[model samples]
Target: MSNQWQPHAAELAEGLSLIELSDGLGHLDLGDSEDVMVMGVCDDSRHAMPGYAMLCLPRSEGKATQFAESAKEQGAIAIISVGVSVDTDLPHLHLESIAEAGLLLRRMFKTEQASTHFYGITGTDGKTSVAWMLREALARYQSAPIWSSGTLGWMRSSNNICDIGNTTPSLLTMHAMLNAACQEGVHAVVSEISSHGIAQGRIAGLNFKTAIWTNMGHDHLQDHGGYEPYLATKAGFISDCAAHGGSVVANADHADIRERAPESTNWYGHGLDRDDVNLGWEQELPGLLRLSCAGEEVVIEDIPIGDFHAENVACVALTLMVSMGIELQALPELLTGITAPPGRMQDVAAGYGQVFIDYAHTPEALERCLKAARKLVRNRLIVVFGCGGERDREKRPQMGGIAAEFADAVWITSDNPRGELPAVIASEIEAGMAQPYRVELHLQLDREQAIAEAVEVLAEGDILVIAGKGHEAYMEVCGRRMPWSDAEVAERYLHRKHPGSGFDGERLCA
Candidate 1:
């Protein structure tokens, strides 16, 4: 039996013709004929199979022509490129741009236009939280399955979750996932749209029914070259949503988002202090989050403990209000059961002091996580964190400064030092702090040892926060991925330090 998967014959028959695909290409020569059937389309030539149409896009890795020979060897029936000719028997279709061809291919494969309502959430911090919350809320009311794709992974319904590597997968993979969801009768699809994904045209062809904007911050500066470009890339999603006759839920607290938000569409703003917003949240005592919208208020008692979570909840509430049209009065009861996503402010019992594992790599994220930790710590707050190599290096010193300002003690360690030396990365982070820092600092190159030291020094009523590499199952070191988990390592160290602490590797709810 062949290991290759094939698409439905009916779908192939209904696929767009070459003439229709090249309709927008001005006077470009589509060699031979335009009557050939496109059974499948792909950008990666390595994944090409018989009857597949390969897209030769010029990427940073190499030119698309570099892989055209391999694609032909694998039995590609057609090649789409921008005036690049390959010595193969396959039909060559020329276009002005490769991205245009990708968008056309995405439209061809996306057959779930009618059954699914797409919601796109884009921002620096709360994309995953908002997407997960929306999925959970919609699942309660809708009969069909709810699919969420983002940092955590692609999830079908509540129990089925799988990773697709990138937060936003390639257009080809996205269309395949959407088609599968359509086959499974999905009613809603929520996705976290990253700036890189938007700028790189990963989500080019899909139209969303609702678009959400979390707060903007300093992130992906290296990829975007600057903050303004990154903000523009995210803002473009809202414009696309508006163009499709969809509504937008924007964060009123962010001036950039408020300014870029579509004024003509059904725009709903959300924030803690903005009176113009449709939804807002105010923190209350005894672990209650009071949510208000349109003269109606709902107080949720089972609120997750975190300052950042309040803002995330407000975003989720606003998104749900716009997407599902659920009454604010009913949200209090519906929201009490929702939980935070894994590796995001996840708490574990460590004798008397609590241990938190979070994927907070950015300076702002670290500051917010420590602030939330400060509120919960009874005695002291100790943080163990590190900056990743080959990322935004400018944030290294900033993170170190935030750690010094917030944490009682800091342990700077390696965080996926992909190509750089671990000690060098640690030193860069240390450079951000004041001379003889206000708090005690420990530099450990080995992450596991750093975690062990933090756990061993934990006193009763103190809190230990393990930041960065939250839900990741492996650590990248020198181009190789090794099995590692911050939560598991922390738990093992905690058990070793205090035997019979009843730490069963389970997260403790706040």
Candidate 2:
């Protein structure tokens, strides 16, 4: 972390009093004076600088006191922890709950009054897509600079980014990023709010400009203990947004979302029959999407094809217009500039047919992408996908059932079997496909081999859809992240089988 992000952190910390920070945490300060200034905030002792306050989260695994001692040795001025007590002479404070961390950190960073707007997106799918798409629109069209934090990383553009190795960053990291964005003159920040992030209090004390619900489905059930609880966690974020006066943009297509979203929501979806904005779109041609807002028809051309893509695009449009105050007349020029986040519905044209690589790990996402591929298929559509380990295990067979129902053939492969046997995960997936195979079913534990085998089966006018782990460059197996890329592997095998295949160099299309 190079002293945990250089002195930019120290710059935020400069002149911030430990007493004020303690009061923000609802703790009594033992500082010598209110002048006891903090130079930075850090969780890792390795990055502790002079006057830095070491923030120890509860998940630090009983090492908070040891880490605080080390940070004190490194010249840290203060310590903030939960339950753990530091023996050092530094001014130490405790948080009653982890949820207070975000508000306290925001106060410490002085970002509570920043002029920047925050748009938070959360749902089962399309979070990454909408986050990037909105950032693209705001960064290109709006005069003020924009940034997005999500699966692709914290980025202003495709090339310009800082990967902090998190989808929803921790409170310290999030406050630091927002502080940095404010320092950079950024006006809008688009962030994907995951279910884990919501439940874990990663975004506590955050006031959203708009809280967007893309759609919800069966994912992350294991973490929440059931689908009802998972839905509740997701819905609570949106409900909180409305309760706090933040604008809500909801996808009206999902009954779950529709039932949960507040009355003040501006909605978009193929199912919406609204008097304000009706966004039921049909593909006029391959890659052409026709969108309507408040009876004003506009066409968004040359985009990724699917109902899910349409849903994502519509969500972006609503956020732009309803929440962001963008005019309908500006829709065509603004919407056309947006692109799907990398590894989402990425396409490649081979000698036989097209090949698609997508981050469709959920059942709804997999079915949507496979159905989209079917639109481009003249003969057959085959899919290659798998679920992650240590996640919602119920979705394993559910995704398998979706694959069998949608694709003409299936290649079930390992995604990220972290600490779980890939073969065992595959067996659970296979249990979903109960009937004698309607088409051929290939179960290959080696993801690269599964992709290659799927590529070999492509025929003239046959589309190969590789789902799950779309833009990811590593496979997490047994707690180790091994280097891997589905796009690169598929491209290499596509070139081997069809010598004419090569990269389009834009979207990895070959």
Best by lDDT: 2
Off by over 4 Å in 1: 1-34, 60-62, 82-89, 110-113, 264-274, 350-353, 504-510
1-510 per-residue lDDT for model 2 (tens digits): 231233223445366777767674657556564447877788778888887888877777568778988888988888888645555567877787776777777787788898888899999999998898888877767766688888777776677666766788776767777887778888889999999888877788778878999888988788888999999999999999989989999887789988988888887767333564435555656666777766677788766677677778778877888776787677778877467776787865443347888999988888888888877789888888888998888888888888888788898889999988888899899889869877679889888899888888788888888889888888998889988878778878877875644543223421
Consecutive 10-residue window with the lowest summed lDDT within model 2: 1-10
TM-score of every model versus the real structure = 0.90, 0.92
Candidate 2 clashing pairs, residues 3+ apart or interchain: none
Model 2, residue 282: C-alpha shift (Å): 3.5
Which digits, one per residue and each the tens of the lDDT, describe model 1 over residues 250-321?
877778887898885333343345567677778755257888776777887766667677777777776777
Off by over 4 Å in 2: 1-13, 23-25, 29-35, 82-88, 271-279, 348-353, 500-510
| Superposition TM-score, candidate 2 onto the true structure | 0.92
Model 1 local distance difference test score: 0.76
What is residue 264's positional error in candidate 1, in angstroms?
4.8
